[model samples]
Target: MALEGLRQRLTDLPQGRFGVAVSGGSDSMALLHVAAETLAPARLCAVTVDHRLRPEAADEAQMVARFAEGLGVSHDVLSWADGPFARETSGNLSERAREARYRLMADWARERGVVGVLLGHTADDVAETFVMRLGRRAGLKGLAAMAPVTHFHGVPFHRPALDERRAALRGHLSGAGLHWIEDPSNRDPRYDRTRARDALRHLSAAGLDPDDIAAAATHLRAAEIGLQHLLSDWATRHARTHRGANLIDAPALFDLPSDPALRVLGGALRHVTGVAHPPRAADLSRLLAALRSGDTRATLHGCLVTRDRTGIAVLREPAMAEASVPVPLGATWDDRWIVIGPGESGMSVKAVGAAGLSQLGNWREAGLPRAQAMSGPGVWRGETLIAAPELLPDGPFASKFARDDFPAWLASH
Candidate 1:
């Protein structure tokens, strides 16, 4: 059954080399085994991320490596050895660890030119996530649970076992005479996921079975898709990007229902700041309220929202601005703009601040507000500002904002 499901998923993916993340757990082991059988030996690889959070993590990674070797698949173990929980200053150790793990795996995949990385998230994991998000009062997107295929930092992630049960994967492994390691963290109870797992047992007794919960998540995903379509249509009609900033037609955005309006604004802010997640709900609410009240200016999420005679503009906040840094030709700047440098050496790019804005010879001719112009990219040669992309027609250098197609951007993280 697991093999059949995986075969169907792989069939829909592009024809190329693929990789799986295995941690010697039952679900991941089953996925690696099934993938090895489904794809040619040359097309399959495995990666194990040893977060170094526990004493036994290295041994577990080696065990996974040996198993992959037995299957005639190439395997590599990636380590996070720089002080375990070193970046957990915010008190969310698990969240930090998960983010680090994905970053490591995505970097590895990109370096190896793999098409996508497979995960072993199961139906039981999806159900647990739904319950966990509900406990935290997550909004619709969070309660919708995980998608079968999603992208992180442009790396494709595929969860082929999202429709299968954890017990079923373990049973398949047992029948094949294979043994899997049990991670102690799953039963530690200190993590929210562990607690949610315990709660699911009780909820299952009350007729709220994991399958039922997962089915509900699937329905919510459909609704989320509908909402995204609406957002894309609205953005196409009302949102405009210029000079590395986003401008939304105030009246059209204000006329939208609160939910869709918030989503649009949230997405715009994220795009400008190049942040993956949206700002806090309360922060979004406050900004929306101020916008609706005709407030002139507000700031959040490393972005500044300003209202003028034309429309509401979302630009990078001058306070959180990026400092001048030497940029190589064709390098990305401020995570949003790509710097197109002159062939000359020692060129640098930085935000055009008030001082730099005054030196622009055609600031008024560009028709951008002073504040917005200050946020645009400025190319410098030593102490002199040679070109401001927004203010100049065609200079020695230019910066282009990375634009996304509305529909595709709406669907992604």
Candidate 2:
């Protein structure tokens, strides 16, 4: 009745090219085996990401690759060269690594034309996540441990195995004669998850059924989903997008239920600006304050959300041309524009690519000063490129002045 439950659940879902993010761990190995046996091997892929954080991480990834190969499944080992990012998210190292791993696997699957990428989250893990988030002052959304299906970036993500008990996955791996790598980090107390995980184990012995916690998460997730849907509709009905910024009337917003209004505003912010505040009590408070305040403009995570007499306009902070770099490199760098003329004249400028010095001959002829540029962070002031850049601008036009102020010659055209 245990492992069979998961196999049956998977069987009920639509069949497609499936993958298991084999972390060289028991649950993931079981996920791999079940997916391989249930779906066509040609359709199943196992992806292991070598974060390269640990000295033995590459070896662990190889172990996962070999296991998947032995199962007659396609396997891959991706390595991250960027050294361990010194980060402390609401969740600790393991949680961040899990997020990175899943995202990498999703990217790999999508590139290879796979429809869905899978995770091996089990019932115990789900319960533990909810308990941890609950203690961390998470609202309803955070309390919902994980969604069964969602999109990460653009790839479809699935955790079909989450509802299955950990023991079931372990038993399945045992029955299938599969072995897995043990991550030493799992036992490290430096992480919050390990502590919460141990707490969940202790609670289980004290008569806490994993199913009961999972049921609570399911209910919470339902509420979260309903709220998200309602918020999306509200945003469409009331929110406005103009000039790459967003505006929503304060009076219109105040009319909605408080909880849903927050959700709608938060969701709108997320849509406009990709990065978002991790669900936490402090983050919620800051977000609410911004929503309620009279400040016409405030910046969060690089995007400026301003509430004026009209409404709120969320625009990306403009950048001045940093040190002279080859122009038009999309991922490498964003190009810059400039305005070098009288403010009263109402001059404005827009240009693409930081080309060679020859490209500036025209702007120079227009008689504007160019700032000696360094890379990364640099800016221009008025007709002259300022040696210094304003960290924040009072308004968008002045901000443009603070940027690489070029001759409006091109913009006028």
Candidate 3:
């Protein structure tokens, strides 16, 4: 394999242990080979996620393990057989599997103290994604395709080979006498990506090749970055967080252009809901239309959005805050609240529902809205309310919002 492309990509990465996600495929195998050669084996770790959707998946994972071990890189295999979609026989399996794969990798990266994981996405993948999203009538963000680096489950994933070609990677592997598994799913027309790949061939014949499309997507990515900067500036001026809710100056937000307004509202919703992606564009457009027509309340993507004379407030849906976790000091509740407890056992972190709120005689004095207060994290020992931090400033257990700063989170995302 040529070392120049991989070396150039590695130059910007921080000095730390890096994890490589290999799926026993050509692209990933090539990445593993190039990265292991470019970086010290001590600084390289390899992981494979077995989705268990195919009978050959386990063997494929073993193939990657053997290859990684041969290269003197530590390897581990993660399984998604027991994940949320283990029994899911319907819906978008591809999307769910991709999510599960990344979720597993993110946990592995954190546990292994790796800075980030490297992926095998290449120019072909980017072009295919652009074509797929174009068919969906996707806007700027979607057409921009896959980013070279992106965060999944809070772990940075680097696609260093985004500018490389799939065939080129395969040829390199072949030249090095390395072998890779070919997934049968790649040929399955039932998948959208397979169809997109077929469409790319026809498009290529018409002189619109993968490289051209990939380059166009790169330009779109630059444009999106510029827009994100504008959104960040606007968010800094108009968005505020109060009791885990994002409050925006409605007049100022609506005064902006439609695209900027949508970006601001979408960012606010994502921040409040802890959802990685923004709400569907159609849903957001409808919500914006309603808000412009004097609607005071709306809901989308597990958030409760309300507009008042002062501004718009995007908050977690009260019912969606039903997630709970044991009071293990550092345990997370609702994927956002970090529990800092009194080191007591037999306690669990739960939403401060109406029952817990009623127990706080001075709840109203806290000045938080009733809905927001109800969704706040509270330590409970069964029916007994142990600590309601949002209501009682001096509670025994104090909790912190993981994404406390809206503007900062907006800028980063």
Candidate that scores best on TM-score: 3
Which pairs clash in model 1? none
Task: Give per-model TM-scores.
Answer: 0.83, 0.73, 0.91
For candidate 2, the clash count comes to 5
Residue lDDT tens for model 2, 255-274: 87776666655654444433
Writing each residue's lDDT as its tens digit, candidate 3 over 199-262 gives: 9999999999999999999999998888887788787888888878899887788799998888
Candidate 2 backbone collisions, by pair: 296-307, 323-374, 338-406, 339-406, 340-406
Worst 10 residues of 3 by lDDT: 323-332
Against the reference, the lDDT scores of all candidates come to 0.81, 0.59, 0.83
Task: Give one clash count per candidate, in the order shown.
Answer: 0, 5, 0
How do the residues 1-413 of candidate 1 rate in per-residue lDDT, one tens digit apiece?
A: 54577667766668999889998999999988878777776888899998888889999999999999999999999987653756556646765567667767876897788999999999999999999999989888888968888766557899988988999888888989999999998998878899999999999999889999999998998888888877887787888777768888999989998988899989889878766678888899889988888857988988899886688889888756655344555655565666775557766777777878777666888888776777777777777777887688577676677656433477554
Candidate 3 regions exceeding 4 Å error are 81-91, 324-327
Can you rank all candidates by lDDT, best first? 3, 1, 2
Full-model lDDT, candidate 1: 0.81
Q: Arrange candidates by TM-score, highest first: which order?
A: 3, 1, 2
